[model samples]
Target: MLTSIQNPLVQKFRRLQNAKERRETQLFLLEGTHLIQEACAVNYPLMTVCYTSKWEEHHPELRSIVLENCDRVELVSDEVIKSIATTVNPDGIVAIAPRLAQKKPPIPAKLTIVLSTIQDPGNLGTIIRTAAAAGADGLWVSQDSVDLDNPKVLRASAGQWFRLAMGVSDNLHELVTSYQQQGVQIVSTTSHTQTSYWDVNLTKPTLILLGNEGAGLSDDLAALADLQVKIPMETGVESLNVATAAALMLYEVRRQRS
Candidate 1:
């Protein structure tokens, strides 16, 4: 077992926590048993896996699977696991996987959530989970948004991160325009809009545009929307959280199509 924190592999895993290191190396860490299981379920390539003897003892079947599938596996000490993981109390398992190669934007089928400058990792993760649950076809995030592979975002996704098809767009306005050309309706949300979210026909191929938590949508991006809709709120309420609004809007599409 790898017990020493000074080991080269342990140090490499610890370095992955930094965004710059992750970007340069094209590898990210997946902490906890659940994220590792989720990664296995999707057959996400596991480059290296470190787990404590206690974890292996309790999860023999999972260990067997990991041994069979992962490229490299190691038994590590608790201190080593803690050093490599971001969680306050890790479940004694973590993994490393290569960042996905750039792919074409998801085709706007039934629903696609288009986000611009969403900075919060938790909010983005929640939105991803909700979109997958609501049967949305895919997700498109602005390049300026939080990194999709942020450890917090991955954990908050509860494994849905692997199941969902997502892409980051360099130019959101142009991407929206492309979707519009394909006859996909672009919908934007705002407090000022008179049109209620439910009034729109979400059953058609659509792209739902959301924006930053505090700033909301950029004016030029908002102008690309074929329709502007609002979620009804109590008089005292100024706005809803970006993730909550995403859940409401996505489920509304699910509700309409059902």
Candidate 2:
């Protein structure tokens, strides 16, 4: 069993915790058995898997499946697993997988989500999960948004990230302009808008723009939108959480399409 935390492979796994390191190495850490299973289900290649004997015994079938697919598997001590994992409870296993490639799909689909400067990893991941569930064709995030590969994002996504087609846009203005030229309507969400979200015709090809949590959409982005919409709430309530707002907007599209 790999007991020493100083082991070369263990140290390498530890380095993956850093965003810059993950970017440079093109690898990220995935914790817990469920995530490993999800990766395997999607045929996501895992370079290595580190597990403890207790985990192996409890999940013999899963362990065998992981061993069959992974390039290498190591029997490590619980302490070693904890050292590389970001979670309080490592759940006795961790796997390393390549970063999802940023391949923009040709012909952006009818329904798309454009996220601008979403700071919270949980919010980002939740949006991804909701988008996938709502049948959004793809998700486009602005360059300034949270790193998609963050562990918290991955965990919060509940494995939906692997299924979603997502890419980061370096120039959101240019992207919106291109979409608009193609006859795709850009819909922006904000409280100041008089138009209720339900009134908009989401049946057509649409790109829904969501902004940062504290600050709403940037003025430039808001100005470029084909329509600005707001979800009507009670008198005292100010606004909804970004993720909650996204769910409402996306499901409206789904409802319209259905």
Candidate 3:
């Protein structure tokens, strides 16, 4: 049992709290039994783990995961485990998982989702989750989007980030424009658009551009869209909530393609 607060591994796990540390070490922390099971199920290369004794009794699957897959496991005191976990009740387990390298070469898929400056963690996470479910092959979030590793976002995503080969780009315009030039049809979601979303050919190489809650897509981003699509709404409602709109469009796209 690695019970001491002064232990070197404990310090190492604490370092994972920072984005710089996670990127530099290629490691991000996954707290709780659900996420731990997710990591093990995906065969994510987990470096280390720590769990409270009580969690072992309460969650047998987590115990099996810790014993079978964790490279190293320490019987940590609850206080020690809590120090590194992000949630209020962390289910008494934390895993250090290495970030997989993004694949090179363009992903050959007709469907993609481009997120621009999406600030809300829950909305961003939900969109990505929906995109994955919709069979989107590439999901690129602009530089300013919320970090996928943020614990709030992780909870919303339900561990989909580990399963999806999503990308992050520093230049939103260049990336979007480049895709537009590549015979790709860029679609923007908007409140007032000439074309209805139902008219879009989702089976083609397409990138759905989404923006921050307040701002919508930037003027430049909007201009780059081959066409903008808006969901139809009833009498009083002006538009769908961002996450709701995203789910409708993405699944509509899936229906169109499938």
Candidate 4:
């Protein structure tokens, strides 16, 4: 068993914790047995997997599967696993997988989410999970937002990240404009808007626009929306959490089409 944190492979896994290393390598770490199982379910390629001896003993079936599929599998000491993992108390298994490449000629999804400057990893992951559950077609995140492959985002997604079709947009305006040209309605939400979210005809091809948590959508992006609607709230509320607002809007679309 690899016991030393100084082991080359263990050190390499440790480097994956940084965003820069992840970007340069085009690989990210998947912590816990659940995330690995989820990846395997989708046939996501795994380069390497490491686990404590205790973990391997408890997960015999999973060990066999990974042994067959992964290019390399290592039995490491718990201390080494802890050093390589981001979580304080990891579930004892981790895998390294290459980043999902963007789909060229983006899928012409009927209900796509467009997010700008969404910095919170947890919120982004929650939105992804909700979008997948609500049957939204896909999602487009601004390139400047939190890395879609952030470890927290992955864990928060509960593995829906693999199932959902997503891409990053460097120029959101161009993306929104293109969608509009295709006859897709661009929807935005704001407290200032009078139109209720339910009143919007979301059955048509649509792109839902969400913004940063603190500042909200940029005025230029908001102005591009074909429709601006509001979630009805009590008198004193300023706004909703981005993820909560996303759930309301996505499900509203689901409700309208159902």
- TM-scores of the models, in the given order? 0.97, 0.96, 0.89, 0.97
Stretches of model 4 off by over 4 angstroms after superposition: 102-107
**Candidates 1 and 3 compared by TM-score, better number:** 1
Locate the minimum summed-lDDT window of 10 residues in model 1.
101-110
RMSD of each: 1.1, 1.2, 2.3, 1.2
Candidate 1 lDDT by residue in tens digits, 179-247: 898889999898887899999899899899999999999999999998999999989999999999999
Clashes of each: 0, 0, 0, 0
In candidate 1, stretches whose alpha carbon ends up further than 4 angstroms from where it belongs are: 102-105
Instruction: State the lDDT of candidate 4 residue by residue for 1-258, as single tens digits.
Output: 899999999999999999999999999999999989998888898999999988988999988889888999999999999999999999899889998684533445689999999999999999999999999888889999999999999999999988888888899999989988888899999888789999879999888999999999999999999899999999898889999999999998998899
Worst 10 residues of 3 by lDDT: 100-109
> Model 1: which residue pairs collide?
none
lDDT of 2 by residue, 135-197 (tens): 988898888998898999999989988888888989889888888888889999878878999
* lDDT score at residue 244, model 1, on the 0-100 scale: 98
Off by over 4 Å in 3: 4-6, 60-62, 104-108, 234-239
lDDT scores of the candidates, listed in order = 0.91, 0.90, 0.79, 0.91
Candidate 3, residues 97-166, lDDT tens digits: the string is 7777755226445777888888888987788678777777768888888887766677777877667767
* Candidate 2 local Cα displacement, residue 168, angstroms: 0.9
